[model samples]
Target: MPQTLKTLGPKAAADLDGDLMSDAGGFSIDQLMELAGLSVSQAVYNVHPPSAGNNGGDGLVAARHLYFYGYTPVVYYPKPTKKPIYDGLVKQLNNLHIRFDNETPFDKLAGESDLIVDALFGFSFQPPVREPFDQAIAVMEKGVKPVLAVDTPSSWHVEDGPQNEGLGSKYMPDYLISLTAAKPNVGHFKGKKHFIGGRFLGEDVAKKYNLNIPEYKGLDQIVEVPVDVKVEKL
Candidate 1:
């Protein structure tokens, strides 16, 4: 039921996600992020087991699950968040002994990794790519390995595509895992696979938005959108 699924714009997507994390939706931020990250990890498992590296909680959440699912995930978080939740996530990974590589160059990680999880930014991001991420995305933009963007790719417009100047001519992601629902920018993704995740939506939010999320089969946390080959027309 591809036609049943709805796509939200940046603001709508952000609002919906906010609702899902708030008490109104009956979910804690960490709980939702954990599910979001799990959804991301499940998507990556289909193509590259044990992956989904990001500095965001989603990335940290993903790396933890990937580790349990049997992938030795290495994190390349250049800009770590100071928030308690994010810090706790990093701590959990550290306790798990997951490797954090702020020292290694992006090119080196890109060359060595089987799949790069583009969790540098998410739906909440608004920017022209700041500091270290700006430099990292530059290297990632030219990489040969496949990439699996968590929600929004770094520096990409939440509602649009990579209209950011430096991002326009760059290489696109190989796979994209859309959290909560697909964003409008999925229409511009030239990736091989597009998935809808963040499966923790409550009826209040979904009904409020009239979202028609496809059912995740069995116990699966994520489902393929069948838009593989290219999501540009989504």
Candidate 2:
């Protein structure tokens, strides 16, 4: 039998700001990010190990650096910009020995990659995605391989799914790895697999926010969250 899954509404999910302070585990946002990245990489390895190549955005790029650990080679397609954030990410990728193609067309990269990690945007991103990201999403939608989204699918509203109409249904991902707690958009996730990572919240913090997150068994850092499960208030 499938395990019972718990769901949280946007109102309750938004209160998960517990990471702002050190919890019982004494994990800070930086530490949580490191663990989250490792968990995401493990999820990818368990489900779909990189074959032809792994393609992704900033979040996936960060995770891939941790995932491959300066060993495996992956591809990244960044928007044409000199933003300091992108510069920092590039520097990290260089240190990790990850390869990226900022000039090649999006469609070409999609065709070559075996898996696509939708890290272009997170739950915070609002629709009518701008510029190169819009184009990048289009190419990802056209590809045949499965896509694993970080947080929420790019181009998707945190409270609403791809109801934007402009992006269309093709923008949905096959798998999702939500950070911290599942966001409101997760309620509409139609993917085959949904996993939650970044589980560093203390019991007191979780209760204060009414996060009601399930416990991670044993030493696992990530837990599967089944879709279409019963909804419960936090």
Lowest lDDT block of 10, candidate 2: 1-10
- lDDT for model 1: 0.75
Which runs of model 2 end up more than 4 angstroms from their true locations? Answer: 1-15, 22-27, 50-89
- Regions of candidate 1 where Cα sits further than 4 Å from its true position: 50-58, 228-234
C-alpha-based local distance difference test score of model 2? 0.65
lDDT of 2 by residue, 107-175 (tens): 776676666767777555766777777777787666466788887788877766776466645677888
Model 2 misses residue 202 by how many Å? 1.4
| Model 2 TM-score, all chains together | 0.80
**Ten contiguous residues minimizing lDDT sum, candidate 1:** 49-58
Assess the local accuracy of residue 58 in candidate 2 as a C-alpha lDDT between 0 and 100: 43
lDDT of 1 by residue, 8-123 (tens): 88778768767876767778878888898889888878867433442212288888988888777889888788899999999999999998888877777777677788888877
Go through the candidates in order and give each one's C-alpha lDDT: 0.75, 0.65
